[model samples]
Target: MSPPPEHRRAPPPTDAETLCRTGRKVIATEAGAVAALASRIDAGFVAACQTMLACRGRVVVTGMGKSGHIAGKIAATLASTGTPAFFVHPGEASHGDLGMITREDVVLALSHSGESVEILTILPLLKRLGVPLIAMTGQPASTLARQADAHLHTGVAEEACPLGLAPTSSTTAALAMGDALAVALLEARGFTEEDFAFSHPGGSLGRRLLVRVRDIMHTGAEIPWVPEHALVLDAVLEMTAKNLGMTAIVDAGQRVLGIFTDGDLRRLLEKAGDIHAVPVAAAMTRTCTRVTADRLAAETVRIMEGKRINALLVVDAAGRLIGALNMHDLLRAGVL
Candidate 1:
């Protein structure tokens, strides 16, 4: 009387498997959508970059709902990458914020459907103000794209949502396209690391790219040094007084002959044989790690970590000792 096994209901998947499968599907779907965009980039993308590069005023970015969030991030990336830009809310634009935009600027609008009522409301005014409008939309034939000076297609064939309603794959495509646009403009403008640091002065990149070794190094009398002929006890006294944990043993020309550190003292103490009577030149390390004053202070981190040492002697082009810095100096300067 029972039905065949094939006709019966199959066992449900385990909860863990269900969750993993769903997560993987979303990621694979979105990844494929982004990958597909590489072939779609064409003349419109170029026109957008050209318009952005030549803009006399800021790039005004706007969108509605989920697209607005993407638009704000796009504006930020463009601004930080040497493109002048900021975001304006489309609803706010319909109010009085439209005054923030001017004829000299370029407006980049985002709308997956190309028919966001809030965005469409201001199209005529933007046109009247003579602002160049660049549209990033999923639908190429829609109003926003049709009216735009240049249209970038950010379409995705499928949404990662099970219901096919969420703005998942679409938003990812839009964000990737915005990044492409920013990078294109960055290349066209010849934006440099120093230029990026200006926008991010409070970030680590600014400290690394903008700070020079001379700015934080102990220069002049602060440089700890002893004559090459000085005894171990004399060099140890110099190191203790200067508190740099080391001293440069220099010649009459102030050229560094060698360096003696607390580590070397420790090694000598282990031997327990006339350690203090040894000449610093004999006990010191002849090959000292040195940097130039023009070098980036941030570079000290790599050198110290790679060489397993904490101090550096800075020399001039003429090979004369000019300055010195330690890990402590880098820490104080916020370069570590």
Candidate 2:
């Protein structure tokens, strides 16, 4: 008998509290899955890292569906962290992308079931090519696990999905395992910050590690300067002409005596002092924060931020003013 539409039973709409609890439960489940993978890492994990490290060519990562997304991210992490790698779609491999794989390269396949048809289809071809295969899968007894040169078991107790169908816990476990392998290989290869900078030249890390003060500082005639004995008016003019909002007060030898800034001008005006009447030295900051040309621009940013100033004087060993850099320069150079 069909139930009346008005009396038909449907699961009650999930309440707000249940929704919040559901989200937390999913997160907790995935977190525990990732945590478990840490202790489960064994000799297979070490062998996988060794295989990747010895790969003379790029690491070609391939998978399908959710595993494919995780594989792409893993490949990126491996490449950026010193193991050159890129992703290949397994479905496309049999069509043509398999040509991208080479004997010098290694194949890293990702599949939760270890029985993805597309992946298995190419396994025999990969074997015939004599290329090393590294598999990341949850099913250790599955066919994909048995044929690999190294198999990294990323098995999880259960999926975070309430239905236990969607890839949640397993995916998190696999991603964490991938991160573990990448970092272990990174340490084993002795990858350095400079090497990391090379891989990420357009990012903030590259700016912090690669840019030096001399690379961005204003030099020669572009520097704003005034003689120590000059009146505050002349210092202000130099500051305006150079557009740095400040001027270095120097002695006859060009050694920095102090610095005068627009902030000093504001305070002087508030005190009802005459700018023309004041000697630059009287209005200048006597103990100025300075940097050398060889310093990392990021350090220069720290100095400005720490001192609450917008400008820095670049001096040599003798403390003579050689260049000047302001916050705008740092911003323009991507140091800010």
Candidate 3:
């Protein structure tokens, strides 16, 4: 006998082609919506950016329903890209949350229809507080847009949803417009990758941009080094003790004169049986690459890769050895 209806296996879908076609159509529709925004970046877009850029407090983004979700994301993007911004729920604003908006703040409200009752209810309060308002909506003639200091039209030709109920292409347009505003403000403020890294210090991007060579390099006694006049055996012993596979040959003042690696020792061993008596300076690579302690660790990785070397010595402005690092150090520091 067959199992109960709820436990029974369902038949495989016979409209796989229809599913794929619908999915592709949705993507194409959304792409077109986003593309149309390129033309909408006119005087109004400039006005919105100018208002946000000049905001002394923050860009307060607010919306209801699906628009709220998009507004939240826009606020996050703005905050991360060097703009001071945060999201406020329109519905909650009527219930004492309106206190969050100060006179110095600029309110960015989103509603595709421009008639969200929750947002409209707070308009009088915003006006009383004399806070500047930027509105993003499909209806340019609606109350929100008419009262806004700057209006960004994110109108879409149609929804990708076949039933015409769900927000699909319109939300995509609004998101793209939000990103454009954020990137514009970022450029206007001269925000750099290093600045962005500070906002995201817990991520890999932060590690790559904020981790300096001085922060990761082994210093003092941990640095494998030998006197320039030392024998090859002494350099080898230092390399072994430090386990960095190389040793720096420095002068009396701790200035790097040359570098000796395991490869050089191997070559020397092949040519001469008595390496113990050979001077380290004679076997070292006279011209070697060195980096300053202030450099980004990511730059050191590129230097090592380009020159086909595994280790580097860090020096001060006067060319005195200060620290040392190898590929293993980079890996341990999460820079590799």
- Top-lDDT candidate index: 3
Q: How accurate is candidate 3 locally (lDDT)?
A: 0.94
Q: Which ten residues in a row have the lowest lDDT in candidate 1?
A: 268-277
Clashes of 1: 0
TM-score of 1: 0.91
Candidate 3 clash pair list: none
Tens digits of per-residue lDDT, candidate 1, 1-336, equal 989988999876779989899999999999999999998789999899999988999999999999999999999999999999999999998889999999899999999999999999999999999999999999999999999999999999899998999999999999999999999899889999989999998887799888889999998888889998899999989898888989999999999998999998988888766766788888899998999999988777788889999987999987789999899989888888
- TM-score-best of 1 and 3: 3
Residue-level lDDT for 170 in candidate 3: 91
The runs of at least 3 residues in candidate 1 whose Cα sits more than 4 Å from the true structure, single-residue gaps closed, are: 1-14, 270-272
Candidate 1 lDDT at 287 equals 90
What tens-digit string does per-residue lDDT give for candidate 3 at 183-298?
99999999999999999998888999999999999998999999988999999999999999899999999999989999899999999989878999889998988999999999
Residue-pair clashes per candidate: 0, 0, 0
Judged by lDDT against the true structure, how good is candidate 1? 0.93
Candidate 2: where is the Cα deviation over 4 Å?
Answer: 1-3, 266-272
